[model samples]
Structure formats: structure tokens, C-alpha cells
Target: MPTPTPWYARIPPPLIMLFAIVVFVAVMTYVLPAGHYERIEVAGRMRVVPGSYGTVDSTPIGILQLFRAFPEGYKVATPIIFICLASALMFAILKATRTIENAVGRLLYKLGTKRAELILVLLTFFYGLLGIMVGYENNIAMIPIGAVVVLALGGDLVLAAGVSAGGMTVAFGLSPINPYTVGIGHEIAELPLFSGAGLRSVLCFGALAITAAFNVRYFRKIRRAPETAIGRGLDERGLALAKPLDEYAVSGRDWLLLALFGDGLAWVLYGVFNLGWFINDISAVFLVVFVVMAACSGLSLSQISAAGMKGIAEMAPATFIIGMAATVKVLLEQGQIQDTISYGLAQALQGLPTYLSAVGMSIGQSGLNLLIPSGSGQALATLPVMIPLGEALGLSRQVSILAFQVGDGVTNLFNPSLGGLVAMLSLCRVPFDRWLRFVLPLTGIILVWAWLGLLVAVAIGYS
Candidate 1:
């Protein structure tokens, strides 16, 4: 018999967590004094002044303001939610036509059992490369597809998220061409653009390879022991889609759908690479695919409409979860306590030795991610102080950026406040505690990886 879910875990974790965090942040607005730092425009973005912290008029979230956070969070989360709904609709159409089942069936048939482990590894590497190529936030839309793929493969959503978001987290955080943290870090440090690429490239690839292996191992474990699945009362819809090897048959229609999927992705990638497309733009492209695939599968207009709505309905709760996470950031910003917290965290690193200071900078960056989820925002807000501090402690500018890159990326893997991470988990129906249970050890391993990398950089006087 399946273990009964605890009373506390019965309510969806995001709703409970959102309520708790919303109230907690609201209370904090009153408890923590409101303050901010001076900002000066540089290259079209405002950069924070390191020592210009000053008290501001307190704007605590009273009862009225506290209640307003949800709508505001929805507002902040709307664009990503839209993208998610659109992608879900597309996948729903595929599911309605059994396109996904056939594709996975063909894959399992072709790969056989021995080579099946490579699926998770390849997907992790592919998504990690997407993280490096396009940018991280934009890839949140792809999480659903990854979920469906893994679900059809009979793996749970925890592994789904581990493959999709985990790949992005490791590679995007350490990407040499990140253009957000590393890019802005270089700008603030007045270094050449994308300088010190060798070390970061090595770290990114090494981390990606390690993450791929981790996810593959997890997949194999659950395949062997179904009782070990992390998602409680796990949805079994996907597991039923896979047919036995003897029943495998890949038809012409399945081949057509496969080509269409590849074609849609290629178009989206082109837009991301050359057209500067973001979430809304990607959704438009997917909506087009949603239409094309429906027409190709001989889905009637009524059938298309029904499948599309079903998909959106299936994803509706996930949209709210994304908003709830976004709400945490919105409330923090509204409280005007963001800078205060940033300044406070930065202040703690003042007297640490060079190596520990490097580690501290990463830790501060990780903690600060909860407050300022954006990579560029974090680099702008914290690098001014961290850079000089690292230099004063005899570490180089590149090393400072490395710490920011790793720290900024690490917390993102598990931070509930991050909409992208939360969006992925909610889409997969994996609770936050479950994610922590699965990822904490990996997070620790990566954290130590960053610390050791920083130690080596400082020891060799890496520039």
C-alpha cells in the first residue's frame, strides 16, 4: 500500500508556502526598516552605489497592502504563465492525438532498455545548452514538454524537473557567455567582455556532465523501485502511455509529428538566436504549432478548441503557483526592504579572509537571489561591493565574477521564490519539500564545487 500523505502535505505545497511567505514578508516589512541605495544609470541600466545605503520612509504592507500582493504577483507572473499555457495547449494536442505516446514508444523501441538511460542524460545536456544559448527565464516554457516526455517514459516529475530545470540551473549559472551575471559583472569590473572564458567553460561543461549523470542515475533508481518515486500521490497518466516492447509500432503519422516538433523547435531557436524573441514571441510560435499539429493530425476545429482548453485547464494551477512565487519578490520590492537586506548581507562579508570571502560572496549572492531573482539585477546590486572586497582580499575581478556566477545559479535550483524553478516544479506537480529532498544533496555537492573552484582561482591568482 502507498504511504498516506501527511496532513500538512495534503494541501498543495505552493499554496501553503505562498500564504506563509506572503504573510512573513509582510510582517518583515514592518520589522525590517525600509532602506535603499543610490543608483546611477550606466549603459542604460541603473547600477547600485555600494556605500550609499540610507533609510527610506517605511512602507510596510498593512492589511490592505498584504492582500494586494497576490494580484501584483499575478501581474508579475502573467507573461510566463501565458507562455506556459500556450505550451501546455500544444502538448495537450499532442497527447490527444497520442503523438507523445507514439514518439516515446518509438524511442523506447529504438533505444531498447540498455540505451534508455541516455534519454535523461541527453535531455539534461540539451536543456543545459538551451540555458546557455537562449537565457534561463525563457526556457521555463519548455518545462512542460520535458515533464510530458519523462512522464511518458514512466519517470516522475521530480526527475523531469531535475532534467529540465536542473540542467539549466547548472549550465546557465556558470555559462561563460551568460551575458547577465557574468556579462554585468565584467561591465562593473571594467574587464573585457567574456574575458576569462576558459575557466567558466570548463566549469559549465563539467557541471553539465555531472548533472546529466545525476539525473540519469535518479531515473534508473526509480525505474527499478517504483515505491521510491518522490512526487506524492504521483499522477499515473503518463506511465500508462508507454506500451510494451512487443507492442511498439511507429507509424507515418508519428514520424510526421516528430518532424513537426523538431521544426517548431528550430523556428523557436532561430527566433531566440536572431530575432530577439522572448516569452510572448515564443508563445505565438507555439500557438502556430498547436494549430499546425492539430490540422496535421486531422483534429477538427471543435477537437482543437477542446484540446487547447483542456491543456490550459491542466496548466491553470501551475500558472497560479508561478504567480505566488512571483508575489514573494513583488512584496519584497514593495516593502522597500530589498536593498536593506542586500546591504545587510553584503556587510556580513566585510572582514572574512580571501578564500572565505570568495565563498561568502557566493553565499551572499545565493541568499540575495531570493530578493532579487534577476541575474543582472543581482550583479548590479551586489557586484559593486563584492568586486572591491574581493580585490581588497587579493582575489581578481574574474574570480569575483566566478563566485557570483556559481552562487547566483546554485540557489535557483531550489529557491521557491524563483518563478522559473517554481513554475517547473508546479508544472510537474512536484512539491517544494520533495524537491528539496531530491536536490539538497546535489546542491551541497555543487556548492562545494563552487567553493573549491573559487579556492583554486584565488590560489593561482586567476585573472
Candidate 2:
């Protein structure tokens, strides 16, 4: 018999997908007509005029320049790349000091035997908040801690996955302050950063509520009938490896580190909301926190340097992935087919009713997300086009941004290409298929809610 290919092996890596997109766009510059839109400064930001798209002389990128796009993409992606690396390094230093493990161990001990459900609720909300503030990808390191807590509470790996990955997925979809999606999307749409936050906050909380309720119901069922859990068939040794709640104790030093970390997070929030800091500014804050935390934890200078390097090395793949994602935009722009694609989409939606048009935009954004999984990458690639299309259809730019946000985030739960999701699931020993099965229904429900949210935005003329 012929050998079967493993499922994981079948799914192409992000790098491969990016290379394919670059080549595809390079070919497209030869086949598709080159075009552009007229741009004008509006209130200190660039805005593409709604009716300015026009076909222009084709600007085909040679094979040489096709390779050049890689370096150019890396340059464009440097801010996000450094931010991810710096954040990972800070977390690595904290891990080297055993601060996070000891603190989570202490939390598990304090929750005791009867309050498992409370643990679930608390962790879900906590991680969701992290998703809103930092990002979903940045929280992959925390999933193992959540798994240990879930096991200590007699819950299964799926519950652990839910509290960490699932919770963050929901929050990422809805968070008003998520810089990667909402911030970038707004900037691309030429709207005020974090504008329409009041409605987004309400929607985010609603998502949290729905996720919490679902997790609680499932946790109770599994506790009653362990065999019904997704991880039921796994051997005892496998479960033991994932459950490490008894591994460490929280000392006075751990408490101090926790306090300092909390304060650092507060500083980050202040910088972002009050000072209008972007990724570069936030990376600097994390760098400062890394130095202070390393000193307070009593690490020698050499040890801190080593740990920081190790952390950066671990996250090097993620940095590469961000850079590769940027190449998609580079290829489209260089080919001059970006505006051509956008103009076609706008013309196709010309006669649709307002509500249906909003829904179509949401659906289209969702489809695009499968190919371009990075929220900021997708925003940079699509929002310029989408905003103009929305205006051409008489929809608010806010509505266009909302569609992009929900589309980019909601689909992340099931997309196999999301590196962070895959890594977290692997860490927890939860199979991808099981996660798909568990999350599919919730995804459907969320999509319905998102459509309704868009309808409301249209009805109220949200902007």
C-alpha cells in the first residue's frame, strides 16, 4: 500500500503561500491591466478618492524585482517584526526567572478543589483581555499554563484550549483596541484610530459572555462524563505530561515580579491610548520592561543577554512570517493590479442593496483572510480597496473597517495557516481536527452575530 501523507504536512507553510502569492502577482502584472486610484491628503492622512480608479500603463515586475520584493517586504514589516521579537524576549526573560510558572501554580493552588468553573471564567476573561491589549499571537506562550490549570481543575485539554486559544480568538474578533486589526484597519481606511470604540467594546463583551457560557456548559458535561471529552482517548501518560499544576510554588519574589509585570502592562496601555503609541513605541516599552524585570529577578547581565537572545531566536520564524506576509502587498502594488482588482470589486457591488452590500463585504473580507492570515497584513492589502468600495456603495468607512476586523479575526479560529493557533494547539496536545470540530459551531453563531452588527451599523449610519 502507498503511504498516506500526514495532514500537517499537507498544509503549506505561510512562507510557501507567500512565495506563491508573489509569483502569482508577478504573472498577473503580465496578464492583468495595471491601474491606480487618485490619492489626496485628508486631515493629515491619505485617502483614495472613490471614483478615481483608472487603468494605466502596465508596470510588470521583472523576475529580478520579484525577488527584490522580499527585501522590500522585510523593510516594510520591520516594525511589527521587532515588536514581536522584543515582546517574546521579555516573556522569555520572565520565563527564565520562573515567574509565570510559579504565579500560575500559586493561582491553581488558591482556586482549590470546588472552584474549577471560576478558574475557567477567570482565565478566559484574562486571556481575552490580553488579546485585546497585546494580541492573540503574543499569548501562545501562556497556553501551557492554562492547560495545567484546566487539568488541575479536573477539566480536559479542550477546556484549557478554550480558555486560552478560543477565548483569545473571540476577543481578537471583537476587541476595539486591538492594534493589529482595528488600529491598522482604521489607519488604512483614513478613520480616527480606535474610533467607534463604544460599540466595539459592547460587542467584545458580548462575545466573551457567549464564549464563557459555552465553555462552562462543556466543562460541566466533561466533568460528569469524562469519556465525552475530546481528549478522552488519550493515555494517562499523555495527560500527565500536559498537567503540571503541582510543578512549582509561588514565592514572595514571584508576587513581586507579578506586581511589576502588571505595572508594566499598565504603562503600555497608557502609552498606547494616551500617547498614541504604535508598534515601535510599544516595542520600546517592552524592551524597558525586559531590562527592569531581568534586574529585579536577580539575573546576571550575561544571563539576561543569553535569555533575550534565546527568546528572539525562538520567535525568529514568526518575524520571517510577518515579512513574507508583507510581500503580498508589495507584489500587488508593484504589479499595479491592486487598484484594478479593487475597481472590479466595486463595480460588481454597484447595484446591491445597502444591507446586502455590507454583508457581501464582510463575506469577501472573510474569504480574503483565509489566504492572508495576518490581521495587519490583510488590512494593509485590502482596506484601501475596501474603503473605496464601501464608499462607492454608499456605506460608511466605519462599516468597511468593521467588516475587515471581524473577517480577519473570526476566521482565525479555524484557519490552519495561523501559526500561533497551530502552535498553541500542538502545545496542549489537542489535535487540529478536534479543535475544528469544537469551534465550528461557535464560528457559525459568531458570523450571524457579525452580520447583524453590520446591519445595525448601516441602520444607524455608523461612522
Query: Which residue pairs in candidate 2 collide?
Result: none
Q: After superposition, how far is residue 173 of candidate 2 from its true place, in Å?
A: 3.3
Give each model a TM-score.
0.91, 0.78
Candidate 1: regions farther than 4 A off? 1-12, 140-154, 231-233
TM-score for candidate 2: 0.78
Candidate 1: lDDT over CA atoms?
Answer: 0.80
Per-residue lDDT over 1-463 for candidate 2, one digit per residue giving the tens place of the 0 to 100 score: 9999755446555556656766877898999899988876655545566666789989999989998998998897787677677777677666777776566666766666578787788888988988887666545546656776677677788777888888988897789988777887787766789999987887787788778778888899988887888766643332233336566677777777777777777887787668877667777877887777887888888888888887777667666766776776778888888777756666666788888989887777776665566776566556777787788788999988887787777888876556566556655666666776677778888778877888999899999
Which pairs of residues collide in candidate 1? none
- Point out the worst 10-residue segment of candidate 2 by lDDT: 234-243
Best model number under lDDT: 1
- Relative to the true structure, how large is the alpha-carbon lDDT of every model? 0.80, 0.74
Judge candidate 2 against the unseen true structure and give its global Cα lDDT, from 0 to 1: 0.74
Alpha carbon lDDT at 232, candidate 1? 43
Name the best candidate (by TM-score): 1
